[model samples]
Target: MELIDSAARAQQALEGELGGERMILNMGPSHPSTHGVLRIVLELDGEEIVNAWPDIGYLHRGDEKIAENMTYTQFIPYTDRLDYLAPLANNVAYAYAVEKLCGIDVPPRCKYIRVICTELARISSHLLGIGCFGMDVGAMTVFLYTFKEREKIYDLAECISGARFTTSYTRIGGLANDMPPEFLPMLRKFLNELPATIDEVDKLLTRNKIFVERCRGIGVISKEDAIDLGLTGPNLRGSGVEWDIRKAHPYGGYENFQFDVPVGTAGDCYDRYLCRMEEMRQSIRILQQAADQMPDGPWNAPEAKIVLPEKKAVLTKMEELIHHFINVTQGINAPPGEVYFSAENPKGELGFYIVSKGGGAPHRLKIRSPSFVNLQAIPVMAKGHLVSDMVAILASLDFVMGECDR
Candidate 1:
């Protein structure tokens, strides 16, 4: 009886506030278009949305709490699950954070390789994002075109990390292994072919009257609102803000690469979509420069204490065997300090904050996932828009629930 009375009171409060005129609609916790178990409770007046409240946490795995129980190196694979679309980027970001906490500097060659990996991840992520966005808005051909290109990138990732989807390739000091001999040749071939494909995609949707009408001026966000909401990545750039972590922070030799940061004028769904398309071209440019300036040197840092010994050395030498055993069993000893590191991920800024008490594992770990942050803008963008326009807005933000709900 008490439970029923509480439910009655809650319903009365909800309906009374809107004067019983607004209808409550639950968009999804499992709908295909919500993108990943995201539920949005929308207050609606006919076709117009009065308010939208996003409900998350369906996919929560307590990743931050889990980090406290695992070694720093042991946590890399978990980052892969955060932004499953760009696992390599997440790997780099988390590794860099641990490296920063430990005061480990990876070699120059390692930095360049990391840059290449991150850019490739960015390109792959954006291709899928754009393709899916197009499909959401009823353009089927773009999905086919983008997936063909994405598969080639997956091949490259597999060559580097031996796994395509969850490439836990980065270590605190460097990568698990250096790029294969054949990797560069395949990368060059893909670079040469990708530009023409991008142009084809551009021509297909950029000027289409139907596409433009559906996207442009829908779900617009101004620069001020975007900044206040802490939006980042292409979503922030799409709002005509010229802020990119690569340009502003310059991590992992990104400063050495020459590329342009694309900005939009209208700050709408169309502009966000355009920002992602142009970003792919910029990623290609960065990749070309990284490939040309590729240096040959040690892949890992010279710190033997932090980096694992080679497997061959561990098998042949007693000293190497002990080093490997100790490092594997105990993990790298991080200094007692706190550090925050963020990378320009496909969605936005993927940041990791670590606090260490001079141990192999973190005292506390926090992940500032971009999808979680960027999803905050949905309510701001969705209000005052028709129900049909909500899909375009959600796609423009390019969020993954894996990251958002983490």
Candidate 2:
């Protein structure tokens, strides 16, 4: 009885504003196509959407606040939970921010290793994005093929980080360890095979009548509005903006590599999909270059205070033992300052803003999550499109709720 009454009230409120001809519907806080716990309030005139409002925050874990309590190094694993699809990239972004705050420059080998890890993560993330996007649009075979490739990348990740999923492989001034000898050969094999798979997926979907009809010219966001909404990554690039954090800011030795950033003119779902596909090729190019020119040197910085000392040194030298003890217990004492660092994550620009008062823990930590920001444009994109078009747009946006609600 009460449930009926609440429904009556909701209908009354909706009707009062939108008239009897229009109906209000809730798409999801649980629907599979939403990709996460995203609820959209839709005002519909038959099958045409008159208005769409997105209600987020279902996956919020208070990640920034949690950073305040843990030491800089301890907070790395927490970053994995944000955009869990690209944990390696998240680890590097956070570590780079903290390193910048502390004025620690990682060794050449460490930089190249980080580049490899980050690019591998990019390919892995885009594979899932493309697969899931295809699945959302009824191309199940694409999902299967992309997942097969993604599993190979996951194997490579496990070889490098010793963890397939939550790889907290980066440290403040270096990596957790150097890449194993076998890792590069496996990566080369994956890279060599990836382009053909990309081409296959492209052939399957890029010109399919159903895919083109569903994706092309739908959920269009103009270049002006995309910039105004602060969209980044393939989403912004799909709108014909050439802004990529990797090229614009050039962190993690990205300046040393050469690659083209793919851009789209239409700013529609199809363009976004194409941008992701081409970006994968570019990532492969980066990985190959980094591998070819990788320098031979120490993987971690020699600064014992910032980076952990070698295990043998800790065992043999009293000073090394004390430094390890102090570092493990209190954390590295970063200088008092604030720094904002952003990396071109697979989803978008994953940024970390850190304020340190010369302590092991951050005074304040803030995350500029791309998913959260890009999600704001959904209403503008989905307005006037059919309810089904909303699904296509959301998939093309390629947002992860973990990062969106972080």
Number of the predicted model whose lDDT against the real structure is largest? 2
Q: Pull out the clashing pairs in model 2.
A: none
- Clashing residue pairs in candidate 1, if any? none
Candidate 2 Cα RMSD (Å): 5.2
Per-prediction TM-score to the true structure, in the order listed? 0.94, 0.94
* Candidate 1 ranges beyond 4 A from true positions: 1-20
Candidate 2 wrong stretches, greater than 4 Å? 1-20
What Cα-based lDDT does every candidate model obtain? Answer: 0.91, 0.91
Across 307-333, the per-residue lDDT of candidate 1 in tens digits comes to 887788999999888878878889888
